[model samples]
Target: MKSFIILPALASLATAHYDLVFPEWRGDSFADGASQWIYPCANVTQEKSNRTLWPLDGGAVNIHMHHHWTYYAINIGIGTLEPAFTATLTPELHNTTGNGTLCIPKLSVPAGLAKEGDNATLQVVTFDSFGSALYNCADITFSSKAVDPTDCKTDGVKDVIVGAEAAKTSTDTANTTDAAPTPSQSTGGAAASFGGAGAGVVAAVAVGLALMI
Candidate 1:
């Protein structure tokens, strides 16, 4: 019985991961693809602007994770410019394996950051205990109006209890037979991505993760 229980714990440790799932993503892409992380906005060529205009005040962004991590952060910047500030969404989150929604609330645009009709990028980064950082980006437009505090607070939030319970339920159905892949299976190099055309931008984070530090 002890050996049987230890097998499940090891399985949980090997399969934890996170993905970005909100703001519709700039490129109409999935977070699991390495190409999505290569640019400030994923699939830049497909759409220069996201039809959805994000609120300046009290805006909520959402994420999904199969595992908990040490730190999670979100940074917003105008166009393809590098982000200067970021909000630490979660500091030292302890649970190692749980699938649910993660929400970052009250996203306030900095003064003089951008005006209405401007293109912007929102980058999400998370650090795991393995010392590997996961990254994702969303391309969005700035909304002219601010959101009501009351509505914004409750509108997009998911119930923590429900999510946690659901994650636990799925564990039994999850495949535990496959062992973690060996390092030899790693892709030898990182993904190469460009920011905006003529901006001479490089997808630094994508490049780093593909190399799997």
Candidate 2:
């Protein structure tokens, strides 16, 4: 009887997932859980009919998370056909908790990697507490206009620094006289790094549950 009850609870937890809230998703990832682990753009073979106009200087990335805690890595690729995702937008792995809208206000494109009128794709990789890597993408065309600041607001969320970052923060606090800033004060927004092109492979980990749309 206990085993039967535990099975359903585990199933519900596995089904809870996230989606790209800003820009636009390539396809309906929520249709299946297995497809979310497909590399590049969650097995999204073709580009979307409409492309979002992203700011040339930098832009916002918003995602609605369902996990209580998750780690994120953002990347970008330039092109319309089989674009190489050589640019990593997040400097380091960012961990956050509470499960709601998580927004990175401004993520600048790597220097000289892209320019006005160029087409590109934004990829977001998330590692959930269950040790599963979830993938999602957004198609965009670079423009001079900026995304609305209001679009980057967060709700019921908190940034968490773990491992080496936690150690460094502890040491810094000991040496400083000022009070440490809260997690809400420093959200996840960092400069991007553009390296050479490489094939971005998606991990095929089986999590037997459907993704929430």
Candidate 3:
């Protein structure tokens, strides 16, 4: 009976969604704030520094989702600026359901923006068919030397391919889904809710610790 009970609980976690797990969290992120939903890099305190050097050329990030989602994006901001770079995440299996994992096999650093010891923020966000959205922020430092992602092992993490394949110049409304419906960029406008930020470039991350019921 104990085995049966434990198994179902684990299964529930496997399917229950809503969390962001990667790129490491900024100071007190997503803490008691609704506006952080709109401002990906909101309320960040760069008060502490991390010695971990993220390779600019070939760094890989991991994401785990309780259920499948329609849209995933990665946005980057340097220093005190708004996000300037956006990329969409494409899973090898599009339009999936149930619990799954997505991985960013590699990260592309913007030219001339990231040098050794530069501070930047990466936002990993996602949207569901219900138009509800989830997001998180990571504070990172640029490494001068390129690192090989092959050395980085995320055993349980799936590789979510990142690129500009689904990117659009405008965050305006458009249907770009392969099968599942795509989320709208505007707030309360369509299938997906981006909190008035629109559906531009963003990334999705799921952390088991921050699961939302």
Q: Which model scores highest in TM-score?
A: 2
Candidate 1 lDDT, 5-38, residue by residue in tens: 9999878654454455566555444435434334
Model 2 CA lDDT for position 133: 74
Tell me the tens digit of each residue's lDDT in model 2 across 108-205. Answer: 87778888889888888876544467788888889887454566788878865334454455546645857664553222111111011111111211
lDDT of model 3 at position 102: 54
Candidate 1 residues lying further than 4 Å off, grouped into runs, are 1-14, 27-51, 80-97, 145-213
Tell me the deviation in Å of residue 196 in model 2. Answer: 32
Worst 10 residues of 1 by lDDT: 188-197
Q: lDDT for model 3, on a 0 to 1 scale?
A: 0.47
TM per candidate comes to: 0.48, 0.72, 0.49
TM-score of 2: 0.72
Ranking of all candidate structures by their TM-score, best first = 2, 3, 1
Compare candidates 2 and 3 on lDDT and give the better one: 2
Better of 2 and 3 by TM-score: 2
- Give lDDT for model 2: 0.67
